[model samples]
Target chain A: MNWALTLWRLASFAVAAGLIALWQLIANLKLVSPVFLPGPDRAWAALMRGFSNGTLLDKTIGTLEHMFYGWLVASVVGIALGAMIGSSRAMRSYVAPSLEFLRPLPVSAIIPVAIALFGLTQGMALFVIAFGAIWPMLLATVHGFGAVEPRLYEVARSLHMSRLAVIFKIALPSASPDIISGMRLSLTVSLILAVVCEILAGLDGLGHWVLLSARAFRSADLFAGVILLGVIGYVTALAMSMIEQRLLRWRTSGH
Target chain B: MTSIALRKDIPSAELEKSQIAFSHVTLDLGGKTIIENVSLDVKPGEFLCIIGASGCGKTTALRLAAGLYQPTSGHVSFDGEPMRAPRRDVAIVFQDYGKALLPWRTAAGNVALALETIGMPKAQRPARIDELLKKVGLPNHAAKYPAEMSGGMQQRLQIARCLAQEPKALLMDEPFGALDAMTRQGLQDEVLSLLDASKATVIFVTHDLEEAIYLGDRVVGLLPHPGRIGIDLPINLPRPRDQLTTRENPEFLRLRRELFDFIKASEA
Candidate 1:
């Protein structure tokens, strides 16, 4: 089993390397115009130049701050509201229909409304990002809290736990697995919305960098921004999984 | 007939002395009658076992006593007060130990949940947690998660957590029903010994007739289809019962046979 897992991981790395090589070959053959598609070498050079001159670093930090703030707001509100709605049948019945109507509406469609409300600034981007990211977390929390083992509630009651105590000690911990997965989804949404908002609002982030580079016909710089965004997404996802592993260590350690 | 009349007259005074009492309790769930006009009284420190066929509301009765569920009519009282909600001094040991225990917590952590709920000082929790874990024979296994432990061990940890409540009354709903025979017997003895030290009033519910006879000072059998008591018997077996000798004892055998017949009849 261990050998099989190692083999699969190796195979995944090989596939990625193969794709990169294919991309480079296409560039060398001029299958697409250089203005349209830059080679990996050119993209790498652009990346190095941007980082060395501190341009990419600033943009990266800006994008990260936008994503982080948006995600944090979404998380706090999502979990709190979810706990309230999920733990009570009456609350669920009263609020779930309105949520359902709102949840399926495209988040991108709300960008104009956000822009109107906050005026094409960082606040507009933040609002759009949080709006897009909140759903997954909120729904996940509601589902998780609602699905707690009924026996545990009985145990809680038998122990004479208060409402707050039950929520914190029993419901919160029980719902954490669902909540964490939701946060992961919400985080991905946060990043995507952050970049979209930045691009549309003409803000100082990777999204704006990519947009400006394209307008200036600097294909290499545009490709560099795209590659950096990919890296950021990959790294953040990896970090989330690491945090998940730590928080849910008991689940995997022996069972 | 006169002696039977006298026996009926004795219950009024007995109800006053009882630690836990159910007076004509009826429970209806989702339009179906679950328990119908069931009345019972358990003396302080007495080990009372309730036995019946499946769907006989034995578990419902235990839940009522635990204050997990309220009767649709009549009342359940603990120490002369109406049981409106679960009391800290009444701890329940559920049948599904896996579900009853918090899977994310270590054995010691699960025990600490009870202490924390009751507002025990954080500074004093470790010693109390250690004492409770040790009491349930999980001294070395305190750091183990519930998932890491065996079924028997998890059940023991559940017991340990319940004991941490320092309960005056323990309500068990087929607690050892999921374990292997050997493990079940081991837990039964462990519980008996624990009760010997605590002298807590106990209400044990199970379908196992021999278990009822072996453990209880008295046994009540319930009839199904809107459950009510069928037969009530007092066990005359000696205390500190040995597994082998108690099974061999004539009185134990007789009570076991009586209970077996009662269950068979109730089922029919």
Candidate 2:
């Protein structure tokens, strides 16, 4: 079984390598203009040069910092609001309609309004990123806390637990699986929105680097920036899953 | 048997000394009556079993005694005082041990949840948690989560958690009904031993007539469709009941047969 799993993993890598090789062939045959689609070799060289000169490293850090801060802010606000709304029947009834209306409003659509408010600043990017990212976490928390096993509440009641005690000791832990899943989704949203905001606001991040390279007709540089963004997404997702595995160890390790 | 007459025959003086009392308690949910005009009194440290068909409101009756639900009419009380809300002195053990336990927490952590709710000092919790786990025969499995434990082990953990509350009464809703025969018998004896030490009043609800007779000092049967007491029979079996011997005793068998007949007739 272990060997079969290893073979399957190797097959996946082979597929990815095949796709890249196909792209290299297309570029070599000049099916796409060199200005639009650079060969993989040129992209690789650009990536190395950018890193050696430290420009790529600075931009990567900037993007990561922006994404992390927005995600953190969204997490705190989402959990607090979700607990308040989820625990109280009256609160849920009152707030649910408004949330339904606001949740689906696209964050990119509000970018113009945000730019008007914060004007090409990091604050604008943060606002846009947070607004886009908070929904998944908030909804997940509401779902988690709301779906807590009714028996656990009965247990809490029989123990004469205070309202606060129920929330902390029972509700929070009970809702954690949902909350963690929501955070993972929110982190992904934060990254996407962070890039969008940086590009639109002309902030100094990978998104801005890509946008500048495109405008300057530096196709290899643009491809390099896009590749780095993929790396960032991969690394962050890997890190988040590790954290999830640790936090929810009980679920995976037990029945 | 005239159950209502049996209730009436109980002296008012004895009623005052009752640990838990349901006086003409009628509960209605969603405009439908669940249990109507049910009256029963549990003596201090007595193990009372309530048995009935499905949807007969035995669990609902247990909930009223636990103060998780209030009766639509009449009163339910603990120690002569109206049970307005759940009190720290009463703990409940639910039948679905899988749902009853916090899956995220280990056995020790689940026990600690009860202690934490009662506001035990942080510095003193570990010792008490250890004692409670040991009491439930889960001393070595403290670090295991509920999912890691067998059904019997999970039920024992639930019992351990409830014991941590130091409750004077335990309201159980078919707590051992889901376990296999062997595990159920083991837990039945384990609970009896635990009660021997704590002397807590117990209101155990189940549909199993033999189980009722084996574990209860008195077994009360409920008639379905707006449940009401159908029979209230006292078990004269000896204490520290041996699973094989007590079950074999003629008196135990007679009481079990009587309860069985009551349930069958009520269902019909």
Candidate 3:
């Protein structure tokens, strides 16, 4: 009887499981053609086969590598530019209009430009991912830096702390929470851009595999790839949340 | 022993001279004059309080004393030299304690900011931090962050951080204004004992008339609309003043009545 409370905590996953069971029941009754819509068992079998044959592992690694490089480059450039622009009113005013003009251009729209510049290679994929991820990180960092309490600046100045020390200690730490949230947003964006670039370029990644399977009429393989991508997205987001919690333990650990 | 021997080499009369002096200082902010030709003298080891209404520019004057702002016309000096910028020897305690201390840093980490600015060796900081926290009656609260402490405790931590600088003069801008009555009285007595032991010159700004009389060797009443001194009264209340007894003293009552009348008339 006490297990009722425990089952309530697992309600989300239990609902997902129930939906999958219903899907299997409908497919078994042939309510729709299995050719167009296969049961969960077909997708699971395809997933297991792909993993055992090492194709899924290789493609996942390729996707992860592309995402990491692009995220890293974006983070470095975003943080540096954000700090400079946010700290100076003149710089912010000068660059803000140009950034605003370009920010609304969609990532899919930029694919042709990226393809022309770097071709269908890893470089092309990196360019696409970095281009897509940088905006959120840069805006978040600028806002974070701008929102620092003015009194903290006075405290540092009155103490006669050196210029570099003030920036590193007070400015950076004060802006970190906002900056971390921005990075989390950029992480999900990077995952999305990586897959999109992979599909557009026909490169070696989950996106390319999913596309190829769908074209060849292997619905189970396409479904399996989609499920794998979902898991990867969920796990990476979970990892980012862990890092954020660790960094912001000071805020949440006590009153 | 070395410092004592070194101190004896300088003339004691030079040490006893006015530590901070504002000579006809006028400050203009955004095309409007905020402080107009105000002159004041803070002698060595003196406790002077500036009491005024909200628009009287008392906080601006305190900032000037801290060398965080420079006068438009005359000179604000320390050790007879004009102050150009904030010096390590002059520390400031602000009223908004929540914004002043770093939220991410623990109480000890906040105090360590002053010590680090002075470039004390890393190995020597822990003991000095413990001593400073103990002095502020916050020995056990060292690991607690500013958000975790009450207003009074956070203010005490701020005071401890300022003390870490070992400044020759302190500029406090209504430090106890945010605390409750009992907490304010306790902190006032603690500040008196701390100043007594250190012999540091202090310029305490407050809107509270009784606080000005209770704490200051002299109370400078400022008139609003471009702040300037209106009444300069010496408080002859005895040392080691008690909260109940000092408030009940005749001279204290007299000074309070005078400052109260001055504030009322300045607003009118």
State which candidate has the highest TM-score. 1
TM-score of chain B of 3: 0.94
Tens-place lDDT per residue, model 1, A1-255, is 999999999999999999989999999999999998998989999999999999999999999999999999999999999999999999999999999998999998999998889998999988888888999999999999989999898888888788998999999999999999999999999989989988999889999999999999999999999999999899999999999999998888775
TM-score of chain B of each: 0.93, 0.93, 0.94
After superposition, the stretches of candidate 1 with alpha carbons farther than 4 Å from their true spots are B1-16
lDDT tens string, model 1, B147-225?
A: 8999999999998888888898999999999899998888888888888777788999998889998888899999999
DockQ: which is higher, 1 or 2?
2
Candidate 2 per-residue lDDT, tens place, A1-255, comes to: 999999999999999999999999999999999999999999999999999999999999999999999999999999999999999999999999999999999887889999999999989888888888899989988999889999888888787788998899889988999998999999999999888988888888999999999999999999999999999889999998999999998898765
- The TM-score of predicted model 3 comes to 0.93
Ranking by DockQ: 2, 1, 3
The TM-score, computed over Cα atoms with residue i paired to residue i, of candidate 2 is 0.93
The candidate that wins on DockQ is 2
Give one digit per residue, the lDDT tens place, for model 3 in B220-246: 989988999999998888766778887
Candidate 1 - chain A - TM: 0.96
Docking class of 2: medium
Q: How large a fraction of the reference contact set does each model reproduce?
A: 0.94, 0.94, 0.63
iRMSD in angstroms, per model:
1.3, 1.4, 1.4
